[model samples]
Target: MGKNRLQLENHLFILPDYLNHPFISGNKLRKLKYNVLEAKKQKKETLLTFGGAYSNHIAAVAYAGKEYGFKTVGVIRGEELADSISQNPTLTFAQNCGMEFKFVSREQYRNKNNPLFLNQLKEAFHNIYVLPEGGTNALAVKGCEEILEEADAKFDYICCPVGTGGTISGLINSSFKHQKIIGFPALKGDFLNKEITKFAAKTNWELNLDYHFGGYAKVTDALIAFINTFKLQYNIPLDPIYTGKMMFGICDMIQKGYFDENAKILAVHTGGLQGIAGMNTVLKQQNKPLIV
Candidate 1:
C-alpha cells in the first residue's frame, strides 16, 4: 500500500495509506475498492450504507459513489441529527457529494443486520448495493490484503487501528508467519475476536484492548493533547477515533519496553481525518482543547 515510509522513531515506520486518495483514504479505500467493483459487476445503480453523524465510512462511501457514477444513500443512525446535518462536517461533505440520507433511530439502526430490516431496505431502494456499517465484509478483507506489500515483511511487527476488524484480518492473512500483527481496537469488547476470525485465514494476529480509551469515540484530554502534539511533531494528522489512540498506545508500549530489543515495527495509518472537525465541535462544546 505504501513505498514512501515515514520514520517516526528508531525502528518505527508509518505507512501513510492516507495519501492514497483525498476523500476515500487509507483502509476506507482498501475496504471499498473490491466492493465498488463488485457493485458495478452486479449492475447496481445505487450504493447504500449505514453510519453515524461523523462516520468516516459514510463520507468515503458518498464520495466513492459520486466518483464511480452511482447514487449514494446513507442510512444514518440517530434521527435527531437529521436537522443538524449542516453543523456536521462529515455529513455535510457526504451530502455535498450527492448522498441521500435516511436518518433512523438508534433502535432501528440496531436492526440493520436483521433479515427483515435488510429486506425492507432492499424493497425501498431498487438495484441497491448494501454495504454494512464500518464496511467490513469478505470483499473488504480481500481488498485489505493488498495493504501490505512483500517489502513489508522486513518488519518484525505490523500495527494498525482496528474498527470492524477487516483491515487487520487482511494483514493477518497476508503477513509472514514470523511477523506479528497487532491490532489496536478503537472500540471496547472481546466481540471483535469472533468477528475477525470469521474472515482471517491465519492466526498471526492479536488485539490490544487497552488502548480504546473509554471505548469508541470516547477520548480524554490527554488523547487530544497527544494528537495535537503528534501532528505538530510529525506533520501527520490522526483522527481522534482510531489512529490517534493506536499511536498513543504504540508510544506507550515502546516506552514500557514491550517490544523486543532492535525489533522493527511498521504501523498502518488508517485514515479517518474527516472526523476531526466533528470531534473538535464536541470538544469545544465541552470546553476542551482541540486537535489542532
Candidate 2:
C-alpha cells in the first residue's frame, strides 16, 4: 500500500493508499518517527510539543511518546477543555495515550520562540525535548525524506498540500530527480513558496501556490459538495481541510490545461481524515448526505 496510485480524470493521480502504512499512516506519523528516534538517541526523558486544539501533531506525539515510553507534554493552543468535555475526539484520545496537556493563551502561544517561553517550560519540565509546533523542525524534514523512498515511481510532478512546509520540503529535497514538486498551500493567503524556500534553502524544485481555494480551514458549500461527489464517484474519503482542498486544486488545474495529458502527476494524500468529524456535523446540519 505504500506505492499506491489512482489515475483520476483529467490526468490527476491520487495516492490514497499512502495512509495504510503503520508508521506513515499520516503526515504526522512520518514527521514524528525521526523526532521520536532523536529524542531517544539524546536520552531525553520528556517530549514537549505545541499544537492547536485539534492538531494531528498532538495526537501523533501522544502515540509516539507512549510507544517510546517518554513523558509527553502537549502545549495546546487555546483555552482549556471543560472538565466534562464531549467534543474533540483526538484530544481525548491523546489524553488517554498519557499526554499531559498544558493550555496557553493565544498571545502566549505565539511567543513560541522566545527565550523566556523556553525557560518557563524548562523550569516546569526539566530535561524536556522541545519539538516545534506541527513538528516543522529540521528533524521532521529529515524524517520526511523516507516518504520519497517509499513512493519509488517516476512521475512528472509530485504534489502535496503545504502547512508548516516540513513534509513538502522533505519530499522536494528527497525527490531531486522528479521533474517538478509542487506544494499547494491550503491556507489562502499563506506565502508558502517563500516559507518553503526559506526553511528548505536552495532547493531545485518548483513551488506552485495556485491552488488554495480561500484560506486555511476555509470551506464553502461548493467545496463540501465537491468532496461529497468525489467520494461518491471514487469511494475515497477526503477531509475538507487538507486533502480535499488539494484534490480540488489538482483537478481544477488539470481542467484549466495546466498539465500535459501525458504528464504523470502524483498527488500525495497527506492523511488527516480525523478532521472529517467536525465537517460531518456541519454537513448533516445542512442536510447533506454522507457519501460513505
Candidate 3:
C-alpha cells in the first residue's frame, strides 16, 4: 500500500500508486493534484471536464471537486448514458459525489475541444475551470512528473500506460537520460506521438502499440484471462482500459526477449479499478469471462 515497488519477478517491479487513494488513485491522482490546485488558485468555484461514461478522469475530477469544495460538471460523451446512470457504476459514483452531468451525442462530443463548442460550454457554465478529457493538460503533466522519486533513478526503464499522454510525458520529463520510458497506449493510433511531443521535454520515451487489444474500451477474452491470472499470481489488480493492457504488453515483451538481460523495469500501476464493475457488465452481455 506504500510507495514501495512490488517485485513481480526478477527485474520486474510495479509502483503501486493505485493504493494512493481509494478513489482518485494512480495517475488519476497525480494528474488531478495540480489541476485542482490551479483551479482554487484562480478562485474558480466550478470545475468542468469531459469524458466517456466510464472515464476515470471524470470520476477523479468529481471526487476531487467535492473534496476541494468546488461544484463539478461532467460533459459525458454518450447522451443515452444519462438515462442509464443507475446501471453504470462510474457515472453513479460521480453523481453521488454531486457532479452534474451534461450528456452529449458522440458527434457533438467530438467537438469538445472546438473553440466554438467550448464557448458554448462557457456560456452554459459560467466561471468554470475547464479540464480537458483524460485531464492531460500541462498542469496535470506537472503533477505526473512528481510520480517518479529519486529512488526510481536506479531503474533502467520506466513504463506506464498512456491515455492522453500526460502521465508518460511527465515520466519523460522526470526520467534520467539513460532511462528509457516505455508507454503502452490504451487507445489505438499513431496520433499519440505528436500529442506526447507537445508536453514531453525529453526524447527518451517510446510507445508500444501492439497490445491495445483493440481501440479504447475494447477488450478480448485473452486480455481478460491475463488480467485475472495476473491478479491471482501477483495480488495486484489492473484495470482493463489502461494498466491491464500495459502490463500485458510488458509481460509479452519480456517473453519475447525484448528487454536486455538484467534490465531493471518499473511499471507504474495507474488505477482505474472503479471501471471493473462496468467492464464486467459489458463482458457478461458478451458472454465473456470476467476480469475478477
Query: Per-residue lDDT for 163-193 in model 1, tens only?
Result: 9999999999999979999999999998999
List, residue by residue over 55-110, the lDDT tens digit for candidate 2: 77777788788888899999887776534235677678778888898888899899
Q: Please estimate how well model 3 matches the true structure, expressed as its whole-model Cα lDDT.
A: 0.92
Model 2 lDDT, residue 48, Cα: 94
Error of 3 at 130 (Å): 0.2
Which scores higher on TM-score, 1 or 3?
1
lDDT to native, each model: 0.94, 0.76, 0.92
List residue ranges in candidate 3 displaced over 4 A.
1-3
Q: How many clashes (backbone N, Cα, C below 3 Å) per candidate?
A: 0, 2, 0
- State the lDDT at 68 in candidate 3: 86
Better of 1 and 3 by lDDT: 1
Better candidate by lDDT, 1 or 2: 1
Residue pair clashes in candidate 2: 187-216, 188-215
Where's the lowest-lDDT run of ten residues in candidate 3? 1-10
| lDDT (10s digit) by residue, model 3, range 174-233 | 998889999999999979999999999989989999989988999998999999999999
Model 2 lDDT at residue 273: 75
